[model samples]
Target chain A: MNFKMRQLFAVARHEFLNQFNSFSYWMMFVIPLIVVTALFKYVNLKFNFNNSNFINMVWGFSIPVLTFFFCLIYIGIIANSVARDKTSKLSEMLMSIVDAKEQINGKMLGIYLLLCFQIAFYTIFILILSKVMNNNFLFLFIGRVKIGLIVYSILALFVSLFMFLAITVQFSCFITDTSQISSATMPPMIFLLEFFSLSLLYNSVGFDGDNMIWIFYIICMWPPVGSTLTPSLIASGNISYLFAYSTLIIQIMIMYILYVKSIHVFKYGLLSNKKKNIFIEGFKFR
Target chain B: MIEFKNVSKSYDGFQAVNNLSFQLHKGEILSLIGQNGAGKSTTFHMLLDFIKPSSGNINRNNNLNIGYMPEERGLYLKESIKNQMLYFASLHGMKRVEALKKIKVWMEKLNVVGDIEDKVESLSKGNAQKVQLIACLMFNPDLLILDEPFSGLDPVNADLLIKAVLEAKKSGTMIIFSTHNMENVEKLSDYVVMLSHGKTVLKGTLNDIYNQFGRSKLDIVGYNNLQKFEGMNGIKNIDIINDNSAHITLNDVSFGKYIFDDVTKEGYLPVFNQHYPTLDEIFKTKVKQSE
Candidate 1:
C-alpha cells in the first residue's frame, strides 16, 4: 500500500509538471483572468456601486465557470495522457510493466492533485486581489468566510473533484484519440453548469426562509449534481448546514461506488480498440 | 511459463481467438506469424488479461512482471522522451532515482542521442519508437510481448532492435512477438505458432516444423538435356536454370538417390543437394492447406 501510494504520487507529480510547463497551462489561467478582469471593470463603471458586490458576483460565477474550464482541461490532459500512450504505442510498453488498475488509478489521482492545485491558486488569487483592492472585498467574495463555510466548501470541492476524476478516468479508457475526449466529458461539465446556474437563480428569486428548507432538502439528496452545489448553497444560507453535511457523506458513498465501477471499465477498455459510448459502456460494467 | 488452456476470446459476435492452447517456456522466443485478422493481436490481448477469454483459462506462474509493445505504437506525443519513460517506469514500482538511471542507460544504449527533454512530437518516427522500446525494457520484465515491434523500422534500426531482443533473451527473458517478416522469425524464433482465421494452424519448434515439410532440390552443371528427367517417376517438378544447369524437385527422399543415379547414367555427374524448406515456403503451404 505504501508503494502504491508512492507510485500514485510520482504519477501525479509527473502529470502536474507536464501540464504546468505547457503553453495550454498558461492559456487556461490567462484566459480566465482576461475575461474576469474585463467583467469586473465593466460592471464597476456601469453600476457605480461603492462596495465590490459586482466583483464578488463575478468571482462567484467564475468559480463554476472555472470549474467547467478546468474540467475540460483535465479531460484533455487525462485523455491524451492515456490516448497518447495508445497512439504513440507507449501504453504497450507501460502495460507490460504495470497492470491496468495501477495505471488508471495513478493517472486519476495525478489529475485530481492538479485540479486541487488550480483551485488553491484561484482561491489565493481571489483573496489577494480583493485585499489589494479593498479589505471588505474579501468578506463579500467569501461571504463571511466563517469556519463552517470554509470547511464545508473544502469537503464539497474534494468530493466533486473526485467524482469528476472518476468520470474523466473512465472517459480515458474508451478513447484512443484525444480529440474524442471532450465529447465524452461535455455532458458532466454541462450538468455541473446547469446545477450551478439553477442554484444561483434560485437564490436570486428571494424565496422566504421557510421555503429554503425544502429547496435545501432537494439539493442535499441529489447524487453527483448535488455534491458540488449543495455545500455552496448551504454556505450562502440557501440551505441548512446539517443537510449539506449529510449530503456530503452520501456523495462520498456514491463516489466510492463509482470509483469501483470505473476501475472495471478501465481495465477492459484500455486494451480494446473498438469504439464505444462512455455511459453505455460504464453501465454495462455495472 | 505462460499457459493458455483452451482459451477463446470474441469481440461482440465475432470470434477473434478460438480455443487456442499453447505454452511459452522460459528463455524461448516464439514468433506468431499470421495474416491480418488472424488472431495475433487478439492472442496478445488475452495474455495481458485485457479481454477475458470467453472460455477456458490463461494461467501465469504468478503476477509475474511482463512487458508489452503493442502493434499500435502507444506514446504520449506531448511529453518528452525522458519524462514519458520515467512515468512508465514508476508504474512498474521503480523509484524515481532508479528509473532515471535506467532510462539514461537505455537511451544511450539505443543510440537515442539528443535532448532527452524534447517532446516526442518533435522527434522522428524512428526516434520516438526507440523511446517506446526503452520504456518497456527499463523495467526488466520476465516476459516480453511485442506485437510487430519491427513495423515501420528501417533495416538498420530493425537489425539493432533484433540485436537488443537477442541480448534480452540471453538474460533469460521469455519473448513472444508476432511479425510478418519471415527472416526475423527464422533468425529469432525457437518455437513458432501460425494462426489463420482465428485458429492455430501450425505450432512447433522451428526445426521440427521445417523438417516435416521434406527437403528436395536439384543442382546441375553443363547439363542441357533437362528433358531426360521429365519422364522420371520420382521427379515432381523440374526447371532448367540455364543451358548448363537445371533444378529438380523430387516427390520424396527415396526419389533423390534414384534421380542421382539416373543423372549419372546419362554421363552427367550433376551436383545435387537436398534443401530444407524455408519458413516462407512452409507458411504459404500451411496457410493454403488450411484454406
Candidate 2:
C-alpha cells in the first residue's frame, strides 16, 4: 500500500482494536441486545403474537428499535474518540503524517467497521439466542420475512449508521473540551432516537398495513433515520417498493453529501479550532 | 536542506513570526532559542504545514520526510507503548517489522525504564518523554523538528537525548530544535537563530555571530580583589562572578592584551583568558538589549 492508505488503515486498525479491547465496548454491544431480546420475549408472552407472523412482527419491531438505540449509544463512542484525539493532541501527531482529511476518514472507516461487526454479531447472537431458548417464534420469522426486504433493510441500516457516524465525527472535531462534547454530539442522535421511538410506536399500533401514511411515509424515507426506519417497514410489508426504493436512493444521496461536507469541516476545524459558520462551509464543495 | 526565506505568520493582525529567514544544510543542527511566544513554535508549525505562512515561503524538497515532536505533546496515555509507536511508524510509511525492530533499538538507546508493551500512562514523565522521542526518530526522518526536547529531563536523561541527536546528525538528518536551555544550544547547534518578540535578533554560525558581536571580553579566574581594574582605559563593564573570577567586557577588541598586562602587573595571574562571550551571556545580553 501507498503511505496514505497505509496510514489510514493503520489508524483504523488501531481504533478498531483499541475500542474492542475495552470491556465497556463489549457491554454496549451485549447489554442492549440482551435487554431488547428479553423485552421481545416479554411482549411475546403478553400479547402472544402466535397468530401474527411471529418472525416478521419480532424482527420488524426489534430491528428498528435496536438499530436506533445502538446508533444513539455509538454517537457518544465515536464523538468521544474524536474529542480524545483533539484533547490529547493525537490529531496533531497524525496530522504530521497525513492531512486532517485522511485522519478523519480513517477514523470513520474504523468506526464503520466496528459498527458492522456489532450489527453482524447481534444478528448471529439473536439467531442463536432464539434457538437456545427453543422459542419457535423466531424460527417461524424465517420464510415469512421478505428476503428482498431483509436484504434492503440491512443495507439501509448500514447506510443510516454511516450517516450518524460521519456526522458525529464531524461534530467531534469542533469539541475541544469535555464540556462541549454533549452539546455538540447529542442533538442529532436524540433527534433520530425520538423520531425512531415514535415511528416504532406508530408502527406497533396495528395501523392498516395496506394504507400508506403519506406524511409519515415521507419522514420514513428521509435519511438517516429513514435508513433505520424504512427497513423494518419493508420487512412487515407496510410500505410500497416504489416509495421505499426512492427513499433509499434519496437517503444514500444525502449520505454522500454529508460525507463530503463532513470531510471539509473535519479538516478545517481540526486545524484551526475555529467555529466558523458550518452551514455555509457545509454547502461549499471543498 | 530546508530554506525559509522572509517567512511570517500572523493571527488576528498580531505577528507571531516576522520576516524570518534561515537555511539548514544537510547534517547541520540549528537551535532556535527564544523566550515563550517568540515564534519558535510558529516556525515549526509552518515547516510542518500545520499552519500556513501569511507571507514569504519555506522551500524544501517536496518528498522530504519530517519528524516532529510538538511542544504540546501528542501521545495516547492509555495506549501501550508498542502499539502507539508502531502505529506512528506506519503512518510514516515504515514497514511493521522494521518499525518494531527500530522501536526496540530506540528503547535500548534511550534506556526507557519500561518494556514496549507498557502503557504510556504507567511510565514516568521522563521515560514517557523518551518514548515520544523514539516515535519521532524511529522513522528515520530526513528533517527532524524537536520542540524543547530537553525539557523535564534530568541531567543524565538530557545527556542521553544529546547523544541521540548527535547520532541523527551523524547520518545527515537536518535537525531543528527550540529550547530555552543555552548549554544544549551551545553544545549542539552549528548555527543558532535567536528570536525575541517574533523577530530574528541574531542568527549565524556560533563563531561568526560572536565575531560579529566582537570579542572584546575576558574571563579571568583565581585573581583575588579583581576590582583593581575599575579605572582601566579600555574596560567597558566588569561582572564579578566570585571573589577570584570576573568577566570583563571591553570598549575595544584590541584591549584584551592591555587588560591582561594591567591585571598581571600586580603579579601572579592564575588565569587570564580573553575569549568571545559564552552563548548564555551572549543570549542574555542580546535579548536584554532587544527588550
Candidate 3:
C-alpha cells in the first residue's frame, strides 16, 4: 500500500485490535444485552405487547432510545480511546510518526467500524433468538411498519451516532489525559442526550403533532437531537420525508465542517499539556 | 542534512526551545544532553513537526521517514509486543511482511528475551526498554530520534542497546538521542548538543570541546591532604572525589609539572596522571556557570 494508506491502516488497526485485550469491550455488548433481557423478562410478567398497536408503539419508542443508547456507549468508547493516547503520551509518539489528521481520521473510522460490527452482531443475535423462540413477534411488528420510513429513520440514527462520535472525538482533542476524559465526555454527552431524552419521552406520550410542528422541525434540524428526533418524528407522522432528509443533510454538512476544522485542534491539544478553558478553544484557529 | 536555523518554540510566554541552531549530517550520531525540562524532547518534537517553532526554521531533506522513541514510554502496555510493534512499523509505511521480518531481526539482535506475543507489561523493565528500542529501529527510518533510550536499562541491556544503535549508525541512519548519562553520550555521540533550560549551552565534537577546555585534568590518588595547591598560580579548581583521591583542574599546563614536583618531594605519589576533563565534569561545570 501507499504511504497514506499505510499510516491510516496502522492507526486503524491499533484502534481496532486494542479492545480485544480489554474486558470492557465485551462488557459493553454484554451489559446492553443483559439490560434488554432483564427489561423484557420484567415486562413479560407485567404486560404483553403482542398486539399491533402496542408492538408499533414500543417499536417507535425503542428506535430513538436504542439510537441514543448505542451512541452514548460509542461516544464513551471513542472519547476514552482518544484521551488515553494523550494521557499515555502515545499521541506524542504516534503524532510524530503519522500525520495528525490521519491519526484522528483513522481512529474515527476504526471505532466507527467497531460500532457497526457490534450493532450488526447484536441484530443478528436477536434475529436468531426470535427464530429459536418462535413466539417473538418483533419480526412481524417490523414487517407491518412502513419499511421506507423505518429504513430512512435507521439511516438517520446511523448518521446521528456518527455525528455524536465525531463530536466526542473532537472533544477528546482538548482533553489532556484519561483523568480529564470524563470532563471531556460527560457534560457534552449528558447535556446533548438530555434534550433528546425529553423529546423522546414527549414523542412517546402520543401528543397531537399539530401542537408543536415547529419545535419538532427545529429539533429535527439539530444533530445529536436531530438524529433521534427525526426517526421518532417519522414514526408519529409529525415529520415529512423531505424535511427529515434535508435536516439530516444539513447536520451532516455541519459535522463534516467540524471534522475538517478539528484537525487543527488535534495538533494543538497534543503539543500543549496545559489545561485551558475548552469553550474558547473551539473558536480559536491555529 | 537536517539544519535548525535559530529555531525557537514558545508556549504561552514560556519558551520551550530557544534560538538553537544545530546541523546534523546523515550517519552522524548526535546526543542531546540535559537535565529535566531542558528542551531535549521539545527539540525532537520540533524536528518531528508535531509543533511549529515560534521563530526561525528547521530544514530537512524532503519527506524523511522518522522513528521516535519518546522519553515517556507510551506503547500499549497491556497489548502484545507483536501487536504494538507491528502497528508502529506500519505507521512508518512498512509492509506487514517487511515489518515482521525486521521485528524478528531486531528482537533477536537487541537481545529481547521474551515472546513477541507476550504483553509488554509482562516483560522486565530492561526487557521492555529493549522492546521499545527495537520498535525505534525495526522500521529502518532515515532519522531515528530516541529520547532517553537507555534510561531504564541495566548495564547488560544498555550494552545491547548501544550495540544496536551503533549498528544503525553504521548503516547510515542519522541518530539523535537525549540523555542524562554522560558516559553513553561520550560513547555514542559523534557530536554533542547540550541544552539547559531551552538554550544550547555547550556544543561541539568530543575532541573539540575537550580541547576548548585545554588538556589540564590532574587526577591524584593516595594523597590525603594536597592543601599546598590551594590559591596556587595556574591551578583552576580542585574537586575531592574521596578522602584519598582528588581531581585537580589547572588553567596552565606547566602548573601540573610544578605541582607534581612539589607534591612528590613530600612523599611517594601513587597516581599523578594528567588527562582531559570528562564529559560529566564539563557538563557540571557548564551548568554551574550558567546557574
Task: List, residue by residue over A1-286, the lDDT tens digit for candidate 3.
Answer: 6788778877777787776556888887788777655544445532354564555566668887777777777788888787777776677777777888888878877777787778788778767766665445555666667777778877877777777776666677777756777766765677557856765775677557678777767766766677767776666656678878888888788767777767777777766667865545634665
Question: Whose DockQ is higher: candidate 2's or candidate 3's?
Answer: 2
lDDT of 2 by residue, B1-291 (tens): 799999999999999999999999999999999999899988998998877899998998978888888887757888899989988887888888999999999999999999889998899999988998998899888998999999999999999999999999999999999998998998899999999889999999988888986877888998887898776788889999999899899888798877777778788887888878778888888889989
Q: Provide the lDDT at A116 for model 2.
A: 79
Pairs that collide in candidate 2 are A55-A141
Task: Candidate 3: list runs displaced more than 4 Å.
Answer: A20-22, A30-59, A171-181, A205-219, A271-286, B220-229, B238-246, B257-270
Clashes of 3: 0
DockQ, all candidates in order: 0.60, 0.63, 0.60
- What digit string (tens of lDDT, one per residue) describes model 1 on residues B1-291? 898899888878998888888888888899999999999998987788766799999988666777788888757777777777777777777877998888888887878756789888888888778887887688887998889999988998898789888888888888999999999999899899999888888889988887786776656666556677876778778887777677777677677777667657768454656676678877887889979
Q: Global lDDT for candidate 2?
A: 0.80
In order of appearance, the predictions have TM-scores of 0.86, 0.87, 0.87
- Point out the worst 10-residue segment of candidate 2 chain A by lDDT: A275-284
Q: Tens digit of lDDT per residue, candidate 1, span A98-150? A: 56667777777777777778768767776676566554443454563456756
The digit string of per-residue lDDT tens for model 2 on A1-286 reads 6777887898788778888998878878788687858855766543344445556667777677767776777777778788777777766666777876677778777888888798788778878877777665554555466687677767876777778887776667766666777765766677677767755765676456556577656676567867777766665657767777888888888778878788777776676555444334433455
